[model samples]
Target: MVLPGKGYRFHATGLTHDERGYPDMNVKTQDLLVRRLVDKIRLNADKIILVDERWMEDAKVVVISYGITSRVAVHAVELAREKGIQVGSLRLISLWPFPEKRISQLAGKVKSFLVPEINYGQICLEVERCAGGKCATISLPHMGGDVHTPEDILAKIMEAVK
Candidate 1:
């Protein structure tokens, strides 16, 4: 779900209906909104450390995931850590504001960032922007309703680092 700005509560279950009523035929505006939120969260999240995007150079790799997809990503991170891969994950509790600066910092330190999502491909763009060509970015996208497994995320992370 490509949402504009954070702190706004909008629900999106599937693609058939753009339930949030995104601005019509205005892709640029939509992209701008997404960026704005990303910045906002990055700046404001120091309190909870939820939206915080600080870099951990020793982490080696970072994984970005949300919703159900994120659940799997969380498991994957755990698995990777157990295997001594030195992985960490940022699970977006807030969707709109993507925490760009924090992500940018993370991008600089981590060797790679993996974005696992259910859509064809969207958030990958923002991940790239924040990465600023410093770190490689990879996407593990799933179109069907079948939930991705921890193994799925692990595979993508492995592929990204390799």
Candidate 2:
């Protein structure tokens, strides 16, 4: 399970605080803890990463989204397919220790990717990283609230295909 973060929420909350919200962890301890947690996830990535993809072998573009945004991504993918665009979909079932290899393999098939998400380009960064300049990657980020409209994603797909 993943808990989406926010600028305000992360700022307002912290585990380092005591009952009265005072510092309970020193800078060194906090840094070490966070570093180790991140290292653990990356070290055991194969056991953690999960992705569910619906892609066409000849697809020129893929629309990838996660969480609620994935719902709209499917709609947009269908709309693009209806328009004769070889579009496909990929849903990020797991957020951390991202499915980098899966995305990289897809980059060999698809010409580009359009990733829409509620947050500001979080997963899109991973896509770009794994893509390794093999193909284009686009981000249709929303600050928060609602998901992307089919038209919005379709428009981006159209742009990517072109």
For every model shown, what is its TM-score relative to the native structure?
Answer: 0.66, 0.72
- lDDT (C-alpha, whole model) for all candidates: 0.74, 0.82
| Candidate 2 per-residue lDDT over residues 11-102, each given as its tens digit | 22357643343466878667766787689998999899887777566788888888998888998888888788888898889987788888
RMSD (Å) per prediction = 10.4, 8.7
Instruction: Give the per-residue lDDT digits (tens) of candidate 1, residues 45-93.
Output: 6653554232334687888887788778888888887787877888777
Candidate 1 positional error at 61, Å: 1.2
For model 2 the local lDDT of residue 30 reads 72
Model 1 regions lying over 4 Å from their true place: 1-49, 52-57
Estimate the overall C-alpha local distance difference test score of candidate 2. Answer: 0.82
TM-score result, candidate 2: 0.72
